[model samples]
Target: MEVPDLRSLRAADTPVVGGKAAGLGELTAIGLPVPPGVVLPARFLNGNDERALADLLPGLVRERGVRPPFAVRSSALCEDGEHASFAGQFHSELEVDEAGLAGAVVRCARSADAKNVQHYADALGVAPGLSGQHSVSVIVQEQVAADLSGVLFTADPLTGDPDTYVLEVVPGPGSALVGGTTEPLALRLGSDGVVVTTRPDWCDESFEARVLGLCLRLRELGRSVTEHRGSPQDIEFCTTADDTVVPVQARPITSLPALSARSFDLTFTPVCHATSDELGALARLDKVRLRLVAESCGLRVGRAWIIRAQASGSPRQEEPTALPPGLSDAPQISFVLQDPARLGGSIVRRFSAVGSRSHDLRETVQLVGASHDRFALIATEIHDAELSGVARRFGDHVVAEVGFGAFVPKGVVATSQYVCTTDGTIEHTEPVRQERAFLIEQGMPRAVTIGRTPTLTPEQCRMVCQAVEVANQYHTRPSVEFGVERDGSLFLIDFVEDGADDAGPRPEDLGIISSGRLAGRVVRVDDDRALELASLDSHFHTDRPGAAPAAVHDPVIVVAALPYLSLESFIRERDATSLGFVFRNCSYLSHLSIVLRELGVPALVDRQAYDRLRADDHVLLDTADRTVAQVPEAESTP
Candidate 1:
């Protein structure tokens, strides 16, 4: 009795029919081509017996003038909201016969509390069992045998740019688009032009225009449905065998700008907002730093530390806290003012010195990647004078703790800097602008060479751009290390604060060998036998009494003075050990660099810094910009 005719429903009936069914009904009411369907209200499952469900089936069949072969889909109440769309999270069964109809409906209804769905809800900040409105409705629709299907965005949700609309098309049902099994033909349309961002060979001119027209119309319909022309919307559509466009679903885009995979520049820094007058304020900063490092370890494989700091006043004898790995030299940590405005004069006076350093940090918190409607609005408010008041009101700090350091499989060690301005413009260094111009002028050459034999490909460049865009949406500069997997999909493995340090100045006499930003302490490998056995046993007995081998300590550099270290042996040794290496005779394009690229090991060959590096001397190799700094030997205080 609670089953409502889909055609008779409207947007206001969302609680009864669920978001999807109500959306379909709204489309039908608006004269959009939506397949005929019936909605079984979530409440109907509360008391109905199998016999009662079976009895109601006949009426639905009669109403649709069809027998069997129904599409049983989930229309959960929490789905397709203005802020979050639980797309593909719930179950949807197609080609369900009359015998299986009741069972399919039951499964769909039960999926509201499914583990993955609940996990997704948690990411959206929805606590389970907290809302009394938790329920799911089943949608039994007459399936449209579609020849083509796809999704469309009324605006560029990634960048929040309303000037453009995006469309994606596939040959069959839109499931593959969501499943990501196949790359769909993706196009972007603006007032002046329509550009094919990505396309398959099957895309004919006629089909392209048909999809374009449908996207344009659906975008207009989306705005009309929301009654807000300014807001962006996500819409899904399909075309039947007869080529009639059918609008399937529509919802408001509730994603953040920086989290999206759009190409925008961003700059990030590790500045915690707390009053200088608060008790244990400095302790809180250390706690935040430790939490960031610990979270990064749990989330991904990496090491993190505060490599630099800014100070104002001289020493007050305070108890020293234990510094994390890569930050043991806290007392002697360098500082330089990049932006005086970042910390006001009063706050600057609190520190003896202000400093910054190059680092690789990655963040994997839920807030950084989820709905930013709240965080985006409150981020600015948290940094104001009333920081404690705002923190109390929000019950949590505005800045979500993010992970940083060597978390990704591969690192695209870049010296290029990108700045995302408030006006939505991505200003970059002259080199970056030149590179972009080259990409545009040369039309994405099949390959790009950093040193030799093009380790960075054009396809990879695109992936990097995508990662940068997504990172920028977080409203921070994120240094990203990303790569394409064997499956042809791109993944962002590392995201960290972009402390924009000019690589200082390049040494003219320093020979540029292997290209990458790598730093470690030099440990001369005098014996080739020791090199081979390094993989077998990480430990070595030094001639000196009770001296620990540097190899066991991470980030120690293995200086191979010989020119003929076996490439295979070198790789095997590096694979088993955590230490980086230095080569005296290897070229940038040598077999060694290629192997390093495959192994994701950071190294340098034939650098002038090595000439002065004695055994156990710690050095920072800015290889990408051809600079190096010798780290002073300082003991940890605590």
Candidate 2:
């Protein structure tokens, strides 16, 4: 029941006075210029005591000769958190006199139950309640009689770049700006300089200079508030007729981008770029799956490492962080393949003018077969999706569109290919700009021109080279595919190994297995012969003396008679990265096909397909088509 002065409270008083009053209190406590205010604590707001609310007027009027005209605003206890901003959702009454202060406070308290507030809260999946009751505190403050008002975001709200500060200023008080009624001057200030993105016709040279000066002065003030709050802030501020800037409110930037430790940085160097000679040195550590080889040599599978979620009886996590697999991502270590493959590449851009609009981000995600209500926002506003998997492609460059990488091979966008050097430097062809992007209408992806200008930036081009350098700077000479995010962050989508070096046979000469599921080196295991532990006839094996295989070794496709009950244990052992099988005939459950299917390993039935394959010869297998084809030796790296 403590109805205290706003200056007497701090940010920790949120549960009592709510987020708005607590923010003002924090600013006031630290000697930052804030409009004087007093808070009617949440518990007192619910007390239904008309007499106790009477102190609000005297407090508003006693603010160092401040006058009768005031602002009464709702400050819900959960108003501003990291996840939801709740901006403009509640009520605010400006220019209220002493006679109307009582009514304004009542309206402010009742705004918590308003339809817009309820709907906005429900969308973010958190109720602003304490102990089963939706709690709200009322803030009666000395309204600033200002020459100009605006909002300042300490960081770039769109891209989450901490180095940028965005200031949006209107000619008068901020109500018109926040209510979406007026066009404001939008200035983006970074360490480099100031850039005005939006300037109204009336904003001339001197007016623009004053606004820019105010923005520069607020830099340290904004930084101080952010440091004190332990996060970037979205602040409401006004410039007085005397040219002094005063902060009116502060709140944590909801939807601030929080990237994890596996952050894909542009300056990152790969684990190792194993040229052909280095690949031979790695023969002692043979793991035939290209994904495994890439990782062993310090190559990332995609732009960033992807982890899978597990189903269980434990508590659910808000984000994915474990290494359990199913169909969504890769279930086991796998290889890439392309028919008639070339040493060319393509830049797979998903979002058009990313960081420009929310719909563009939605459309970008829709192309990748991902959709959610969270992605819905205004055409020009882009918000962060705290944790996300932007784009993933499992297609071996067969078809050019798919939702997610399915059991079948497919891509997410239409793109033209470019040729690159062994070190992943773009050489012959200039990358094409995607003419159109796809948006999800109903349940299907439809081509649209809404998000265009989706070309790669120079920074994005450099990131692609870096991503590809680590992934394919090896003997494979793989055709690399990359995804450029909406914020211009680049990710290496996949690498398609044609299994051909410059001196080897063209990929098509190796024969066709319809399309491929994954690739592995051939090691024909007949029904009677026990598998050898030694590396053999292929470059993948070292023949290192005294080397013994363990429960977790490299993968090899066994070509022999149908799987029997005795071979089940050997096939199921964890010793191999992931074992595959090739039999002469096919059946669903009669042979070991059921187990192989359950384990998500490659299995096929075709006798003639083995004619072109031999021990240690690399091959791509299509389990559904029941065939396998030899792949030529991979090329050398940089």
Candidate 3:
């Protein structure tokens, strides 16, 4: 057959135009937003067809005003089937003009015999047909410049939930994602709602909202395609600057895992009311007032119920104090705080365990107040609240509590330092995107990327505002620490007695994490976990193996929070290149600091410097000069 316009073709034309083209043809015929294109048959590529198409190729560049700058892609006969995908194994030339179409088509056709194609076919158990024998048609279609592009799986591959779909999106061309240099913003969407698996640094509420809408649309589109194609499909799509989602390709998922779910008891029991005496186990707070204020904003107030030896944590201690009958013995949630009051160098003890099964509860484990120091919020299963001693457990003071709570499992969480005014207006210290955190799964914490993180919704923020107002009533400019759930549920972790000194600008005139002298644009990795930034010199570390590997050569400051052993390569990679580094949050005594000193390139590890810079932002960061200034974008040009 001769070159077939996309709309003129159908599913029956797979032998000539191949699956990718036929699929696009079907989508176009069914009124989808696929860029218009025409396909040259596989016979031409495999040398069984005519060469005269080249003379006609430039004339067919525009299929009715759908002009070049076209994208020429491979659509082999053996590809896009239920058994094999051949994804990224073939060639795709983007942004080609009419004059370049003939050459691009030749390149894509020749790639059918590339070694990578053979290797992929062999791995997939396909018979040796990838040599000079594979049939790969060429598709020249309008290339849509995307604001965001990604891949969407119609079913949850991780949990095997057909009802759930996953979308991974990047800021610019989808090639960046394939390049392994950037992590895409991931979303889990179902009939219920959208859950942001990973939030990209640039992803704010508005960006998230737009993506959610696009995801729902894609879901509808996928359903339509699946109905026609007869299986759950993997779709590659792009959202243009105009917010139009164009489906470039779709194919049936070949090896979707079976449904498997992890069971962990991270649920909370009902609220148990208690008198001020029982609540007094927690330090220095009006528990009765806290309960009223916190519960009003839907925050569970955790209070410990002191026990003497073998006392079961049950009720009979006032209204709404009913205890759970079959509570597990494990501490489902643990927040170990060093009590901000113990400032000087001292022994320092646990803040308190509301649901801890530990026989040795701290002398005073209070859960309410400002905590600027480190704290552990663990979630597992709740058990008995048994304590060995009430007064004489070799203690400074006696305390108890009947409480169990879980924080929003670690991921990309937005933290804001703000002061709530008497009128309930909040002066934000700015929402600082934290580093990759230890997300607890099955009671075990593992360091993961942003995809495991949750975006704080507006409702959650409103509740925080309300909770802060309550704290404001008790203390001057009181701040509240809250654990936000994946579903945007809020829990009042604690009401801080100390937070944001009038919520003013952090004294930038002091405090630097590391010291070096250099200037460059900043590329924020958003993965704040230090152990992960070890190879800052040569590569932009992200999850997943990239389809294309690259090393850093541009003069840019790499920003990350965590630095691990693999980071030593940063020195070698940065040696003669335009690479600088910044520690978003780190300590001077850390290994990353040592690397910073040894790093011949310019480097700064100041939180302020990190906060001042953004992705691709021209900057001049110097420790010796103690300056973090923005350089003009034009100045960064060679």
Candidate 4:
């Protein structure tokens, strides 16, 4: 096979013998540093016995009298097309010995028939026969130890900025350099001295200068190719430690678009968690809005508006109300609030409408009003007799509950009132003081006197002491509740009781025996002579079974579960059921309930009762209501 010199094959020869082989042949003829590499000419692809080419490569390497490993690569004529540049479409093998060079060459040639190459050709709209007719030319070059190697762009591929050429150099193997995994030293070069903006720690100033010089030479080569092909060209070149800079490949840079002088300033605050399509829609709408604003003002837009919003406040409250009518849900309101003087007459009018009291009208009005902080009128439900009482309470105070259409000046404030009747049911309140007292008076030894009834048995006292001991031992921080004996010992109660003891008193056989103050607070002992404290809510004498003795103080324990707690496990646990027993003992009818529905169990809360119970701690009993559970005292700390 006769090897053609680089100067003999111009741009036309590249169409015939492929760009890579043509470029190398041209480099050799121009006396470039490219190693002596022979190409397996394009015509060798005809016969089914193409393996014969591989058989010929070994003898050629032997003819060169060098046993060094050779690099076998593919050169396809149609690969670096102006419309479709196939960068990695063909196979290239490295580190092949002289004995192995022939087989590597044939394998590289056969890779033209690989599935990836076929798919790539198909994607370019090239017919199968057209693709099959293209042959691969194998370039066998002597491998060099590359200290610095990378690709150089004649034009800035990123911004298409023509003023400077971008050169990326990696100080390693060329393969790793091209793949972009390693950070390379990047330089922007023009007529001025090389701009060494990004110098890798592995590369020195001398290496950078050499790479810059090589890039300028390659740019000249690309200009020649562009002159011959009538279009800009992309050249791939590499340099080694021995100062060998070889242009391995060249292609037309097809991605260049016409440069535009017209510029736009886009401003947008992206909504959190917005999908790609939603964001696109928002961008389009913003562009339209900006255009409309600009057209109305008859001035080029210098700045665009951007609105940013964040969700705030307690999770229990509803999200901020939606934007009002005549405005999209995403409100883009423009106002001159920067100066107080320019605000009044500067307001621009858009769409406005009036409404009557129909349902649709009411809804539309509400939707519009919700977007503003204050509305013109207000309505509230108040106790009928307390109307005068409330007005008197807020005398001269700047508060109001005015009717619809009642207008007030922008800065003027006023107070208004309305009243209604209430049914004669007393709302239960929290036992705050009692719970506080129980928490304060815990763990002190004090005297106990039994009522006219019999004193509690020793076993019963021991059970109570055991309960208090468990509370004292385990509760370094606040606990739900603690069990205590009259003698000041701690005890723990079993949530699940198998059988009641005949010798010891039942949990309900307990009552307040006597009471006294300790640590600036009051304490009491039960009838079974167990130490107990009262809740801050009104108490109740329930006919419910297993109820504890009536006492001056009833302390309820409150426990809240985290969101991840399994509701099934919570319900199945014995401790959860025992909470009812503790609630009955407390006698206070208001309980604090925290719902962890997200954890699976949807907890029902009595908001009114819970709010009431959270406020106070006095144990005042009333036996009428059974639905409300009592509140507990704050847990005691040792």
* Top-scoring candidate (lDDT): 3
Which stretches of candidate 2 lie above 4 Å from their native place?
Answer: 48-56, 59-66, 128-133, 259-638
Scored by TM-score, the top model is 2
Q: Least lDDT summed over 10 consecutive residues: which range in candidate 2?
A: 531-540
- Candidate 4 residues 511-576, lDDT tens each? 110111111111111111111101110011100111111222222222211111111122333223
Instruction: Give the runs in model 4 whose Cα sits over 4 Å from its true position.
Output: 1-8, 48-51, 62-67, 129-134, 196-230, 259-638
**Regions more than 4 Å wrong, model 1:** 64-68, 201-230, 256-638
| Tens digits of lDDT, candidate 1, 1-638 | 37766766666678777788877775554345567778888778766756777777767766655545677888878788877788888999977888778778888877876789888988888656413345888888777677888887866877766557887888888778778887888988776777889868878888777776665554555444433212466777777886667767777777736332211112222233322342133323422333343343332212222222222233333222333423332322222222221111111101111121112111111112121111100000000010000000001101111111111111111122222222223322212111110010111111123331112233434444544454455424444444233344433334544333212112231133333554566666554432222211111111111111123324555666422223333343333234455665332222333355445555665545557678878766555654556776442000
Model 4 worst lDDT window (10 residues): 384-393
Candidate 4: residue 442 lDDT (0-100)? 18
What are the per-residue Cα lDDT tens digits for candidate 3 across 149-175?
888888777665667888888877777
In order, what is each prediction's RMSD in angstroms? 28.5, 27.2, 21.6, 35.4
Model 3, poorest ten-residue lDDT window?
386-395
Q: Rank the candidates by lDDT, best first.
A: 3, 2, 1, 4
Q: Model 3: residues >4 Å from true position, as ranges?
A: 46-54, 62-64, 130-133, 202-205, 258-638
Residue 352 Cα positional deviation in candidate 2, in Å, after optimal superposition: 43
lDDT for model 1: 0.47
Number of clashes in model 2? Answer: 2
